[model samples]
Target: MKKVCWPYFDPEFDSLSERIYGPTCRVCIDNESLEDCTVVKVDSLNKQGLLLEVVQVLTDMNLIISKGYISSDAGWFMDVFHVKDADGNKLADQRVINYIQQAIGTTRDPPKPKAYTTGKPLEPEPHSERTTIEMTGTDRPGLFSEISAALADLHCNVVEAHAWSHNARLACVAYISDQSTDTPIEDHHRLAAIEDRLTTVLRATTSSATAGGNCTNQQQREAKSGGGGGTMTNVERRLHQLMLSVRDFDRPLAMMEVASEEGGKASVLIESCREKGYSIVTVQCRDRPRLMFDTVCTLTDMQYVIFHASVDSHDGYAFQEYFIRHVDGCALNTEGEKERVVKCLEAAIERRVCEGVRLELSAKQRVGLLSDITRVLRENGLAVVRADVATHGGKAVNAFYVRDISGNDVDMEFVESMRREMGPIDLAVRNEKSLMPPNTADHQRPRFSISDILKSKIERFSHNFVAIK
Candidate 1:
């Protein structure tokens, strides 16, 4: 029988007594009873980062909940969300409901009886020449992720490829095959969908300069007519646009898989650990879509505060070093906890779906890229708080502080998932903490680093180092 198993930490996780292998409580999204809001009820055995996972799922689904109630006791949790879809309408999609169920560690599909079989491996499917996925777009951080994600959504499995960038332009060509059939993609509609998704992402990559103008006339008409959903005045809209340029987003992370030529594996080493203190986490993994984001997200979900991060990617692997402490300012001393973290990170980086705030890109300084990024955020039920855009040797390095349109922090467990969790309620704070220093007991200012000094000098010397558009 083919068997699947969740990553296990120790005897407890592997034991039936722990209920990790027991019948899981069914997860459900109850919408029929509510008129204005959907009720998402999740009942499951509690696990680390379980709460944040729920939030991430809800946020990714573009659901807005006016209120929520949570109760947990004796290794079990029951969370309810009074929610509505991104369009401010009732949530009724069975597919979405099923997704939520599966995401929260519950399943509605009837369990298939185990199949008896010989232990011999099945014969492999025939191989073929690969369909190629090629991309030429703005070069920036997380750029590869956008391309890889588009391919993944089309169910195209990467076989091999070459990717590079020069002067803010990126070119990537991937040899790929259908994941299910292990053959070259022959479906024209699927090919078109892949191309269309890639194009949209590329547009987003270089879109800061071209966004918003086309919608301005329509927005003005709507504002004057008092019929559209927005309530911002024209002046407010202009100011909002201006603010977009000055905001510096956090550095986005991406991971991509390598072809056969490059052997790939993910590994983690936790050192300098003490009870109630800090640890140094080192992760080495194959680059996959959102690898950086997933790593950071997992750390945050586990309530770790990153005090320092050093990152580098070469060939086909990524190496990341992190100085971290728990949110309560404690160190992880248990092997089980550390193992859980390592496994969680592995799962996060390998995830292929574009659920929640997953896609990020770096691009050339297109005339309206910022405007476009902002517009896309609004359209996709995402909110951008802080951003940083700079040009380096004619190429732009930009970062964004973004969250799926969930407002307010759901306690400290989700600070990383929420990006600007500690900032003011509205996205109006001048000093952003999307990437703040490790949380300090007294909240003292972080000691200066070389880049900090250089950043200050650059701002002092360049009149437009961070000037608003």
Candidate 2:
């Protein structure tokens, strides 16, 4: 074995480390530096997973990252981002700027684990009226129907939810409350029963056509209640982590062939840098919000350390490059390993590109609301590819990206009829031209803001549904 000298052995390394990791953190915003977008410059320590953390914060705020330049190969981390709000305007709100600064600067110290002298963690305070359920299982048609039906049967009202499926694996997080009381269910037995019911529904498989093969493996059928087992901060990010944990990247041979055939314009290329002891991965695809966050989250969860990276978007296309290595400090040494990395990165990028029409719904909160909505979709031969469910005040504001059961484009005529049947005032279809595949051309992405949708729903909530808090 060859011996490698450690960089920290030099005494000067200590001073440099202290200076970079000092208590003071800086996040500068310069609107004058860019003609089209606001520029955000960050100088902080190169902490593990720091890149993903920053990207995640901006993404969750619904900010669009037009371009990014990252350099964190050493102790210091420095980066610049060109960002715009959802409406394609530079960030102008002082409150928003202050929030970004605080969020980026306050991550130096990770939250400490609770004291566990008795070998058990302290139970967190119960969420006032919402209980979140996290589940992972086989991906199949009508799976969401079954899960929502089960919850409805148990007298639970779905408040908010998100689900993702890829490579024949499904993961979902749902927030629910007592249907009658509108409060969180604290009974241990009831919670366990809910878990059992949902687990059974997820484990039931009707065919072998599921993309990755039969899902009889015990690891796939899992259901946990109590607010994602007490650590569910970001539902979408948790979905990524759950999918990675189950190795959803390992697609079946037939599925891989189909994906390759339908690869569209997205491409991933891996190149070796033997001289530098690093492997470079480049991804090219249509530009959209949260593109950088998705790739960075996948890399961090896969145990690959990104030493340096660059991101840019132009003419409706995105280009991202990463210099990465295994956490073991070794470059990819085999073709098989490289291929796996490529497949995983591709999966990460595609998982968020929902393939279907976008439907936005707003209604008064009530029991069996979710079940009824999903049942209608199932009856109309529509399958949900992505869903975001949320509630505010006393209204449910949700979005569903769906396709036909046969995996074809939905008929707009039929969708219009369905909307009419379901009350056109409550259910509306937005312009999803921007959500098209990367190969699509000449379609300008639309500006759809979740906050704006929520506000509109809340404003229209006649006195009947308003709750005086």
Candidate 1 segments whose C-alpha is farther than 4 A from its true place: 1-22, 59-62, 69-74, 102-469
Model 1 Cα RMSD, 1 decimal: 21.8
Q: Pick by TM-score: which candidate is best? A: 2
Which one wins on lDDT? Answer: 2
How well is each residue in 1-469 modelled by candidate 1, as lDDT tens digits? 9999988677655447437545565577777888877788877766545554565556544455444555444567666766666566776666666666666654345322111112112221122355655454444445555555556666766544334332233344445667787567777777777777776676563344223122122111110000111111111222222222121111122222211122333578898845425688888865432345456566765577665455555544567776676778677778987876675555445322121122223445333333444444444444433233333343334444444444432122232232332222111112222111134232353421222333443444343232211
Q: Candidate 2: give the clashing pairs.
A: none
List the global CA lDDT of all models.
Answer: 0.46, 0.74
TM-score of 1: 0.29
Q: Candidate 2 residues 1-469, lDDT tens each?
A: 9998866686666467457566445789998977789999998777788888888767756788988898887677899999988778888777677767777887546442221111223433233457878888877777888888999999998877888877777889887888888788789999999988998888787667444544566767788887422222355678888787667777767777865555354689999899999999999988887789889988888889888888999987899999999989999889998888887887788777774367777877677777777877877677776787777677777778776676544443454454555553366554344434555442343433322343344454442232111
Model 2 Cα RMSD, Å?
9.4
Worst 10 residues of 2 by lDDT: 112-121
Per-prediction TM-score: 0.29, 0.81
